[model samples]
Target: MPPQSEVEPYAAIRRDARSGMSGRALERKYNVGRRTVVKAIASAWPQPRKKPPPRPSKLDPFKPVIDEILRKDLDAPRKQRNTVKRIFARLIDEHSMSDVS
Candidate 1:
């Protein structure tokens, strides 16, 4: 993936080229491909990334209980806060949640 830093410069070069410079001049000035300069001039902003909706998790059935456990932990000391293993243990031991291995 192109970093946002790189994208920012492409937009700048595109703007500079649009101001008066030729395509070849912009390519030489920015040390980039002609196609890349064309792409830069086409859009100033990074295109929004499309992400798929989340699939349901194996732990979805127990999310409410997990939320309660995490909420309670907020008032506890940092060292005493529950880790994932601790939460898993608590879920299995207290709620008789089984099937996870």
Candidate 2:
């Protein structure tokens, strides 16, 4: 394994690369791997990191829309009731919705 000091330089190189510096330029400046430069560039910048254990779907922004539609369907008279497929179709057609699953 490489020493921690070596790792620190790559982190710095990556930070510099994110600020409009090219990886090749970083490699020349830092004398590290082009691959290392690339890795550094990726690591240095702030990114939309994935949430751990992701937030529950119940709290999702579209939840209210889905709940309202479902409630309306469930409350309708049995003789003219909507099925799950029909409900989903309505959501797609009218609300431009989709299931993440």
Compared with the true structure, what per-residue lDDT tens digits does model 2 show for residues 1-101? Answer: 95565557767885686688876788888877777776666665434457789558733766787688778868788877777677667767877776643
Task: List TM-score per model, in order.
Answer: 0.43, 0.35
RMSD of 1: 7.0
Can you list the residue pairs that collide in candidate 2? Answer: 14-40
Local error of candidate 1 at residue 2 (angstroms): 16
Off by over 4 Å in 2: 1-52, 55-59, 98-101
lDDT (0-100) at residue 85 of candidate 1? 94
Cα shift from native, residue 51, model 1 (Å): 11
User: Which sections of candidate 1 miss by over 4 Å?
Assistant: 1-55
CA RMSD for every model? 7.0, 10.2
Q: Model 2's lDDT to the true fold?
A: 0.70
Candidate 2 TM-score versus the reference: 0.35
In order, candidate lDDTs are 0.85, 0.70
